[model samples]
Target: MVSYQNNISSIDNNADADIPVAQYVRMSTEHQRYSTENQQLAIAEYAKRHGMRIVRTYADAGKSGLRIDGRQELQQLLEDVQKSDIEYRAILVYDVSRWGRFPDPDEAAMYEQTCKRNGIQVIYCAEQFSNDGSLQSTIIKNIKRSMAAEYSRELSVKVFAGQTTLIKKGYRQGGSPGYGLRRQLIDENHNIKGMLKRGEHKSIQTDRILLVPGPPEEIETVNFIYRLFLNDGMPERDIANLLNNQKIISETGRPWTRAVVHQILTNEKYIGNNVFNRVSFKLKMRLEKNDPSKWVRKDGAFEAIVPIETFRQVQAVIEKRSKHLDDSHMLEILKAILARHGALSAIIIDEEDDAPSSMTYRNRFGTLLRAYSLIGFHPRRDYAYLEINRTLRKRYPDLISEITSNIEKRGGWVTSNPDNGLFTVNGELTISLVIARCKLGQNGRNRWIIRLDSSLKPDMTIVVRMAICNSTIFDYYILPLTDFSPETLPFKEFNTFTLDVYRVDTLELFYQLTSREALQEVA
Candidate 1:
């Protein structure tokens, strides 16, 4: 057995002369959060100052703070103190709460009694107070502890509420800040007051640091990724592989993972929306699962890096196309079909003038400035094409060959001189024609033989042409052809509109009849 020190005579349970002293450090879930490390540091300093030999230390990363007995370290220490022949005489800690979070206050009282009754002294190196039969003072302390715990829970709620409000206001809790664009604190006027740049706090904004969306290079990367995935249907893993092979690093210069790719694909932040408390949990415990409903969602919260439709399209494709290597063939086939079908349902209203139209192939647009714009004063067809081919293929694969096959043109199917009823050469293929008059443009590009005004927009025309792009027994691939270039088809006021639809005895004729009757009435 170790001997007690003669110099420390205040407590009867002081350590014997030769045995090293032990420090008991614990962090209950309630206390182990952001400030636990500070507790450990203070206890170490206390042990050093007293010239005591530091024998051992016990720690719990994320146990509950409800009970003293709930703490393994406390139980072990109490058991050691109870042993008649144990050499340790003193137990040290940072505070009493570290002793227990919300145990039966009686347990705290009892643990203290056990130490006093036995030959062990309980010590709080920081509080420097005791539970030595001082019942009244201890009762008051316990009351305050209870209030503090309540306060902690209240504060947690308030913090979550505040974060949710921030996101709803278009502010995204910043994640790993991108290059050039570091996360910053701003005053009411959106001026940078403080910043986290390169994982370090800085006072001033340097030329190299950007407080905006991100560096141009990073923005370009984001755009590239959107195009590659949303626009092209590339799998998440494939996209990650592309980045890794190209030697591109994340915002922190680390290799990309499938999780990162998944996040990028799933992040609605690109669409000017914000998510709240993305990485928070029930406790600071590792491996803690969070409730999805608890996650916050806000719209119009930030500068949208991408359009909402583009973001939606990417999500839809991900949902439809499985991301497994074994399903690569099936994914590849679906993607090919999807690419041709285009994201027609994604509401792509924007288009690049000089470039090819985007995934949205079907659109409702009409112009009658050109001679062919209107078929003799008939109303123009303003149907947007959702180019729903894959849906058709998947929903009815047996009819793909017929739907994709072009219709054969029959000679003299119309009036003798062919003044009307001139269908596109391919008959089986579904096609629509908005019969509207075309007018001439003001200058070189807009000039048309049929119109006098050059600055005038295309006038409205009755859509009257119909051809079968695809057909089955009940359904047909019908696309209402909008005026591709209104400048070329100028219409005059004196013109008469005509619509012609070739309907067999049985096949689906809803579309054809709709066009024919609508045009005939206008003419």
Candidate 2:
């Protein structure tokens, strides 16, 4: 049996074997019927009727049901169920929808199957039919899952339509107003309410948000940026540098970046236009950049800070200046900049008046590092470390693929999430693999820095350390989440016995963890 003596802390030791159960509750800004307190009341009543004792509770308050990515309580519950010393025999949820409104109904089923496979039954307290592997229950559950998913889709459409209407009505929908603008709160009749500070929002439903001109200095600075770009024909990088030189920072309270300057020059908000649907990330799915034709726009919606004619002229000039240059020409520009400055960096490349923006180089060559490599420019200091990181990044996908293949070969199921490159093994363990770059320590010993993504909270993390040459795998450290929790960990060639115990030369032991053994038939 798997030892989980130290993993779970919420188990009730006093609860006896006569029907000890756990309750799971989830709320996603829905009606009060789905609130945690109400759900718990219903669950408690059902448990009493069913002769079950509730020993623990798991809840996800104000979380979305579209995906399990942000549902920490649900993730923890799934992780706990796989352990042998779990105190509960069954999990009681308010309803099937509370279990999850997963877009793919199969995802919800897979989670349920994981619990059932581990001998823990998932009991929906409010469902009409019994969850005893009956045909009626299965059909109803599947239908309910589909209905839950459809509800989210319908809500998304209604919300989008409402937002589009508000946009046309000259009210802000979401996101912060740009650098030289401020969010103004107003009433239903458009009476000026007040200016919203950063990170502030309207609490009343009837209140609306509008973009208005900010401080006079900020407005003047906005105009200055346009004049510099249009009249003086200063590049975005040069404008950014000039702002920084004058001790002026962007709205984000950071030194200005070339991209930030370019955004100010191009965005229609400065010209009082409301633009929506430039990008879409609906229902917690993939992000997509919508075409200009698909964008919802309203001309003269916000308070204008820059003249529309000037904005138009700047746009035209920018279009003409950014006319496509062939790869050879681009390289020649980079070579010229490097020869003049005696070095090349993103800032240097962007600062050059005759060269394309560093972003353009990234788009053309995949990365600035790749562009530098093409020109045989190996920069010193941090740039050398960035080169190493680039190589490790290139190797990460292959490593994930290799690990997935090996796990599957051992008869273990692997569900690889394309979004995060994390693997759920056999529907029980979530595994994350990270590459640790090798460095020389102060003591002159080989050291490695392991940065784990604590947000994902994988059940197991495999740190693949690079050798001294920074090309090959030095060794592996398979750490369970219970054993380590820091976001960053530094390791030497040697360590304490407790930590060194987890270090290994190969992944043979890891494969064994996922390996399946055939059982012999008994008479």
**Model 1 root-mean-square deviation:** 31.8
| Least well predicted 10-residue stretch by lDDT in candidate 2 | 1-10
TM per prediction: 0.41, 0.67
Which one wins on lDDT? 2
- Cα lDDT tens digits, model 2, 148-238, are 8898889999989998998888888889898999999999988999999997889999999999999999999999999999999898889
Model 1, 1-523: lDDT tens per residue? 0122322344444443333556676654453332557776776676565556656665655655554323556666666677787666566666666665442456565676787678666566655334343575467557745654555466667868876766676654546543324455665566656655564644433212223466677777777888988767676667778989999878655466554676766776666566655566532322233566766887775566666787888777765543433323433433443355442222122221111122212211122122112222222432223332332334332222232231212121111112321233222323222322222234322111222222222222222212222112211122233422334332321121111121122323432332321134664
Pick the TM-score winner.
Answer: 2
Instruction: TM-score for candidate 1, please give it.
Output: 0.41
